[model samples]
Target: MTTTTPTPPAPTPPAPAPPRRGRALDSASSFLRRRPRLRLGLLLSAPMLWLGLAYLGALAALFATAFWHTDSFTGQVVREWTLENFRTLFTDEVYRTITLRTIGIAALVTLIDAVLAFPMAFVMAKFCSPRAQRILVIAVMTPLWASYLVKAYSWRVMLSGNGVIDWLLAPFGLDSPGYGLLATVLTLSYLWLPYMILPIYAGLERLPASLLDAAGDLGARPWRAFRSVVLPLTFPAIVAGSIFTFSLSLGDYISVRIVGGANQMLGNVVYDNIGAANNLPFAATVATVPVVIMLGYLAAVRRTGALDNL
Candidate 1:
């Protein structure tokens, strides 16, 4: 009887349900997964389009405007191509002097920033604990959070007679270097020092401590080791920082206006033409000077692989 009861077979289980087709989004994601290059291209397309339309388009318009001079009688832009602006920029002694002065200031600022930044960056990267390094980084960047005008005006006050600098130097019988070229340089150096410091800090952080120790073991003095090893390694980072400091100084007008007394840079010339003189063509022409100089500087830097560091 038991065997007969067992003879009744168990009911078959219900068949498992088939998976439904994926949604449109899932399908697209699967497709993209198979074509990584296409996915990357899609991601970059929007930014590239915006850059082309906004930045490159504006630069093109500026370059075009530079060729067209203003009608003196009408004070209106005349849409005609001419090189009179270039001719004047080259031939006029005032413009030439301004150009040279601008270059010299930019160069001096770069040199000063390099000299000051290297040691601070080395200390930050090699000596400090990680927490201290972060605190120092925040300290360096804190000034950038303040308004540009605020910083400039603060410097203006400090550079004024009997200001903080004068007070500090009073015991030494020294006066504040009043507003002028020196003030301009000092202000610009302060403004751009962070830009210089961060890059060199990054470079130094990437440097290996063993190299210094190895050099020491090889009977190299600190100065010799630094000149032969550290300097060469960090040179590209310095150049990368120089790009920021140099270009910013070259095109700076606000800082100059605040602290640069009667002295003028190429930026001042450009600002004067557009605002006071109402000469857009000449202003655009003046704008090209920095652009061209940067292009040349970049070309040279490209050779040294400094651009890669940036």
Candidate 2:
């Protein structure tokens, strides 16, 4: 009887409840996994929207503003569309000279940077050990971390009479090429050198050492190998670097103001129109010059397949 009274059967345990968030997450992950294109689109949507709104929107606004004009007496922007700004930009002698000067300086900066950066980048990519390469890269990038104004002002100081450049050249019959077009060119070259180096360095890094070796084995001299094998491959990268240097120089006004002395560039014109002259439409029109130049430059380089590297 006592045995029959049998201990009450243990109550069956209740089944555990499934976690809601975990199920949702797992389902989402599976859904995303099944549609990789959707996943990718989702990932890029935010950035693309930002770029479209911020960059392209601003550019559109600028172009729109360029067509309008300002009232000279009232000093208020007139929303009416007209080609007067374009006419002024195209017809004015001062604007033409400034445009030419801007283009010339940008070209010179691009050239100088290419010449200087190539050898340095070549040495870094082909010759240096990994640790040394890292150190050299740091050295190259250190200047970039400094304030742009600081670097510009530093050059200003060095280019001043009795400053570093003058001091260095005093022993010789030469003198510092003081603040002007020459100074502008030098400062721009220095400032944009890193932009050129980084691209060439990245390009050269991808170049096969085997190709260089093969050229040498086939009786190509060092210079010949470089010209035939290296230069052609690296040319796209040089063009890419030139784009950065050229566009940046084209739009730069601050460095010119700091070290350009009496000289002015297109950027100065835009700056003066916007600030001193209070002419927004004219400034937008002036700003379009560089944008047009860059577009043409990009179109020219597109044939070279340089855009692929970017």
**Overall local distance difference test of candidate 2:** 0.93
Worst 10 residues of 2 by lDDT: 6-15
Q: How accurate locally, in lDDT, is each candidate?
A: 0.93, 0.93
lDDT tens digits by residue: candidate 1, 120-219: 9999999999999999999988887788788889999997886999999999999999999999999999999999998899898988999999999999
Which candidate leads in TM-score?
1
lDDT of 2 by residue, 207-271 (tens): 99999999999999999999999999999999999999999999999999999998999999999
Clashes of each: 0, 0
Error of 1 at 78 (Å): 1.3
User: What pairs collide in candidate 2?
Assistant: none
Alpha-carbon shift of residue 165 in model 2 (angstroms): 0.9
Estimate the overall C-alpha local distance difference test score of candidate 1: 0.93
- In Å, residue 259's CA in model 2 sits off its true spot by 0.3
Please give the lDDT score at residue 87 for candidate 2.
Answer: 97
